[model samples]
Every structure is written in C-alpha cells, then in structure tokens.
Target chain A: MTEERDPHLARLFAEAPEPQADEAFVDAVRMGMARGRRMDLAGALAMSAAVGLTCVALAGPVAQAVGQVAGQVAPVMAELFDVPGGEILAVAFAGLMAVSAMVLSRVRV
Target chain B: MRPADSLRLSNAPEAQVIALAAAGSDEAFAELVRRRQGSLRALMRRLCGDAALADDLAQQAFLQAWRTLRQLRSPGAFGGWLRQVAVHVWLRHARLVRPPLDPIEDLDAEPAAESPDPAARLDLSAALAQLKPTQRLCIILNYVEGLSHAEVAASTGWPLGAVKSHIARGTARLRRLLSVEVLS
Candidate 1:
C-alpha cells in the first residue's frame, strides 16, 4: 500500500530550528578525543608490557613441559614409525605453538 | 598532510577531510566535526528529546569516529557514518536506562491541554517526544534529515518495510496531534 505524504508535517520538519554545537561543546569534544587517544596509547603499551612479561614468565615452564613431553614421545614415535629426529620435531612443534600463542594474544580480535 | 595543511583542508571536500583525518590529522577531523555537528546535533536532539544528552552523545560519536576513522570504507559516506555512530550511541544509552514499559505510553496518558492558540504553541520537539522511539527515529531521519527510506533502513539497520511502516504511522499520529487537516 502506498502511504500518503503530509505536506504540513514535512514543512514543519523542514522549518524546525537546527541545534548548534557551541564553541564549548566543540572544544570539549576535541579535548575528549585527545584524552581518549592518550588512554588508548597507554592501554596498548600496558597490554604489550603485560604480554611480554607473561611470555617471559611462562618461558621456563613451557620449555620444561615441552622437553618432558618430547622426551616421553620421541622414543615411542621412533620405535613405532622408525622416525629419525623425533625429538627435534617435537621441540620445533612446541616452539611453533608458543609463538602462535604469543601472536594470537596480541591480535585484537 | 602536515599540521599547516589542516587549515587548507577545512575548506576542502569532505572526502579529502576524511582521508586526512584517517591519516591521523586531528585538524582534519575537527573540520569534519565542525561541518557536520550542527545537523548531527539537531538529529540527536530530536531523537533523544534532550539537548544536553544529545550533545554528549554527539561528542562520543565523534570520538568513536576518530578512533575508527580508518575503518570507514568510503570517505564520501562520512556524514552518514557519523550519523550512524550517533544513533548507535543513543541506542546504547537508551538500552541501558530504558524503562520497562514504552515511555510513549506514559506520555500519551498525560497530553497537555490544548493551547488557546494551538498552532502558535505547537512544537516540533514536543510532537516528536510523543512518538515511539523507532517511529520518531524513522520520521526524523526520513523527513528532517532528508534521507530516503532505503537510506534510513540502511542507517538504522531496520528493514525497509519497517521503516516505511514507521514513517506512515508516525506521520499520521503527528498530523492528528497537531490537528492538521487532511486536504483531499
């Protein structure tokens, strides 16, 4: 169904006074943006610091765990599949996972 | 663009201003804000029914735009993008503080007594305050801001049919409230 147009309402809306943003409002917004930018910078720096510290803190434990797991699995894999360099492969896989975790943590989404 | 170039961008086209603003030029962003604030503020006031809140929301919207300016795919659509931000800000605020029942129903029960000179006392803001939120949004965006129905739908993320229905019903209600006579 076609809707009827109202000339009176349209005229009133057209003639309605537009609200102005005074100097104070503009300055306030500008200042707010500045503060927001500062906060954003501070937040990103804090996050980066936190992530770096976390990786540093976890490095020893992660290395130990990866060593133990690799030690346990390498012989089994070598015996089962006759694979060479199983221990090196496990260490490389663990390093890849740790690097992936660090990268993923920094990603915003 | 350098700091000195901002003064030049003030008079430049919106696309240029948006591009510079996205490139981290505060002055360019300020220019865009100065250019669009009036209409955005007006739209917010009509939508929110409070000047102070409208200004607050508009400012927040501008800040948000500044942060995400690079995400703006089309520089030419800056005005619409800014408006959509303002509307979303208002909607978020509205959602947080909205009452259980529709506020318009409460307003409807307490209609002001007709003025001795009805036409003289009629106000666009007052009439708008009487409308349901979605209806008022559609009405202001369509009639006041001069957006097409599809544009309104795209901006509000509402369906095109819903936008049309709201405009139709909202206009009819407004005419009745203002005692506008139908001219066949």
Candidate 2:
C-alpha cells in the first residue's frame, strides 16, 4: 500500500540482519524435495492401485454391459458393414481394449 | 550442486536462472535458492521473529517452490511467486501449531511484555514477536518486503481491508514498542 510504509520502519528493516546462505540449508532443502517427490510418487501409486481395484471389482458388470451392448449392436454392424457373427466378437474385443486403454490412461501410473 | 557449479550460474540473469530451474535443472534451482535465500530467510526471520524457525520454514518454502516450479508461468515473476509460497507455508505452519490468532479487536488485549534489558529494547525481532501472526505477516510483507497492501492481501488470502488494518495497527504497535515517534 502506498500509505502502508513508514520511513522509520523501512530503515529498521533495511538494518535487519540477514542470514547467510548455508550449504547445509541447501542440502536440507534438496533432501526435503527428494522426500516430497517420493511421497508424491507413492500417493500416485496408491491412487492407481485403488482405481485398479475398483475397476477389478466392477469388471464383471462392466464386461456384461459391454457384451450386451455388443450383442445389440452386432446385428446392425453385420447389416451395415457386411460383417459376420465371429467378426462381431473382434469388434467387441477391440471396443473393450479401447475402453480399457482410456481407463488406464487416467490412472496416472 | 558441486562447489564449482556454485559460480556457474551465479552471474546468470534471474529470469534465465528461473527458466532453467523451471525446466527441472536442480543446479539451476540451487542457484536460484542461493541467490534468494538471503532475502527470503530475512523475511521469514522478521515474520516469525526466530532465526531457527525462520530458516526451517524458509527451507520448506523453497522445497515447495521446487515442487511447483514448473507451474510458474512467468519466470520474471519468481520473486513475488516465491514470496506467496513462503507466506502460505508460514500460514499453514502457524495454523497448525499456534492457537488461533487473537481477533483484531482482541489483538491489543495484552500490552507488549515489558523487558528491562536495553538490548531487547533495541532489537526489532523482540518487538516483532509481540505482534499477532496476522499482523506480523502483513507488516513484514508490506514494510520489509515492499509489497503493496493489495499484494499482501493476495499473498495472505486476506481481504484488502484486513491487510490495511493489520499493517496500520501492527506498524503503530511496532512504533510504540520501539519507541519510534509517530508522525502524527
């Protein structure tokens, strides 16, 4: 603030003793940064594992939904693209792989 | 950083050093810390009025700055950005360890403790330690660090009115403690 300053206080602050840079302080910060990084990594891994477990727990329902959707869409696909029944399984597998890739991409691990 | 690496980036411009540090060069970050430690530590010392705690908090601030360095959009803004980081760290630490600060109305409940020693009389740290945490942070950020009231407001997440109030009252209290004659 323009009005916040006082000359006397400024002078005292100017006169305040400043600490010298210590290599030890630098080392301490370096160690702390490394530790912080490890903690971040561990947190990310934990979150990934939690997400993985959730996906595993939901896998049966998810697979069943996908299969049901594929079954309904397969007739339209065969009529539209002249695809056969067995090839519809390939399309379903490909769709499942694409969805799994998407889910895994968001896991951050 | 190697002892030889100390002088390597010492002479580089701050913006360039900041850019390199943002690029994840630890050496550059080291240089940035070395160049900045003096003022940052001094700011912490004035804010907390304790050398050891100030350094500890300053180091924590630097570690935080390092972790978030890549998010800095403007390397030229590092000084202000770093100060904001330091203030946040201080706020977090204060909130965790210290009792909630006395409300502004109650800030003057206790007169600054009397000290018989003349040295303590002359010591600004002793006087600063008498301020409530909010007042102390605002006073230091405004006076010592030369931040504007609005800047201090943004830094501490306090309203502009509150920052102005704290600085005014804190400065008045400091003048009274130091026996510095008020202009009024």
Candidate 3:
C-alpha cells in the first residue's frame, strides 16, 4: 500500500518537526572516520611488531632447520633444474623464495 | 582542503558529490553528509525516538556509507542507499536492547524518557518508539517518507508481505494507543 492509504499518517508526519542539518553532526562523522582509519593503522603496526618479535625469537632454530633441509634438497634441485652452480645456488634460490613469501604476506596484511 | 576543491564540492550536484566521494575526496563526502543529514537524521529520530541516539546512529550510517562508498554502483541512488545504511545501523543498535517498556498506551500524555526537547515531546516520536523495531521501520519508510510497500520492502530488505504486515500491525497498534493525538 502507498502512504495515501492513510492520510492521517501523512498529515502527522508533515506536521512533525524537521531534523536540522547541523554542521556539528557532519564534523562528528568526519572525525569518526579519521579516528577509525588511525585505529586501523595502529592495530596493523602492533600486529606487525608482534609478528616481528615472534620471528626474531624463532630465528635461531628456524635458520638451523632450514640449513639442514637445504643440505638434503639443494643438490637434488640443482640437478633437476640443470644449473651449473649446484647446491649453493639452489639453497640461495629457496631462501629468496621464502623471503619473498614473507614480504608478500606482510604486504597483504 | 584546498579552497578550489571545497568550492567544487559545495557547487557540485549530488551525483557528482557521490562520485567524488567514491573516488576518495573528503570534501565531497562531507558535502554529502551536509546535504543528506537533515532527512536521514529525521528518519532516524522517528525510528529511534531519542534525539542523541538518533544522531549517533545517523553518524554511524554516514561512516559506514563512506567506508563502502565504492560499492555504491549508482551515484543517483545515494539517497535510497544511504537510507538503507541508516536503517541497518538503527536496526543493529535496536537489536542490542529490548524495549525497556511497552510504550505507554497514552504515549503523548507523558514525557519521552531521553528526549526532553519540547518539539520531540509531540505525539509522533513517542508513538513510534512504542512500535516494535521492524514495525517502526516499515511505518517510517512507508508512511512518513511516502514509499510504496514495495519500495519500503526494497529499502528495508524485508519481504513485501512482511513490510505490509508491519505497516498494518503498526498502524493498528498506534490507533489502539491511548492519547495519541492522531486518534484521540
């Protein structure tokens, strides 16, 4: 049904006071939006820092584990890829890939 | 903001304002807020019955609109789109709390709990607060704003049947309310 279904409602609404277009309300919303953006940035920074600390704490063991894994796989990768610089080049490539993955994940965040 | 940008924002048509806002112009978005605030705020007040709460929800709606502005495909549809946003915000806030009391049958006979403004003390705002949230939603969109039932349904994302039902029930309930000046 349309509003004309009830003329009383239309008349009542028409007689009600109009809400004012207060500049204060606009400013409040703008401030709220800016504050929200700042909060998001602060939250992202805090999360990044927490992740960085965790990575630092685990760096020693993680490096050793990667080193052992590289010893096992580097030669095989080099042979498979048919590279002249065998094991060292394969290990370096793997390390570069891992660093790239980390950077991408951070960027996505 | 640059003086030229501010000038352009104020002088621009609504569709231009929406486009500029979508493209990340703060001044244009502020202009949108300024232009649209009156009606949106009024609708919120009718839905909520408390001036402060209505303003808060209205502000939240604008903030939400800004955040998702890029998703608004049609700039010309911003008024309806913003009403949808405002309705969503009000509904969310309303859902968080049950109505404290069944609105007094004679809603206009007494003062509104939070709204002390004499203009707001009038019958309509108090009567609206008494209606259930969905009922109130349908009434404001359909009756006050003069939307057809299908338009109210579209704006509220309610089924057309449900919108009609709420309007029917709300109107009857308000008619039953004592001391509402319209019926009294």
Top lDDT: which candidate number? 2
DockQ score, prediction 1:
0.40
Ranking by DockQ: 3, 2, 1
List per-model TM-scores for chain B.
0.81, 0.85, 0.80
iRMSD for every model: 2.7, 2.9, 2.2
Candidate 2's iRMSD = 2.9
Lowest lDDT sum, 10 consecutive residues, model 3 chain B, at B100-109
lDDT of 2: 0.80
lDDT of 3: 0.77
In model 1, state the lDDT of residue A26.
72
Please give the lDDT score at residue B74 for candidate 1. 94
Model 3, which residues run further than 4 Å from truth?
A: A1-4, A69-109, B99-122, B176-184
Tell how far residue A109 is off in model 1, in angstroms.
25
Choose 2 or 3, whichever is better by lDDT: 2
* lDDT by residue for model 2 (A22-52), tens: 8888778778877887998999999999999
What digit string (tens of lDDT, one per residue) describes model 2 on residues B1-184?
6767667688888998998888888888888888888889998888887789999999999998998998899988899999999999988888888867543543446565566544555458887888888888988888888888888888888778877878888887787778744222
Q: Would you list the clashing residue pairs of candidate 3? A: none
* Candidate 2 wrong stretches, greater than 4 Å: A1-4, A47-109, B1-7, B102-122, B180-184
Between candidates 1 and 3, the DockQ winner: 3
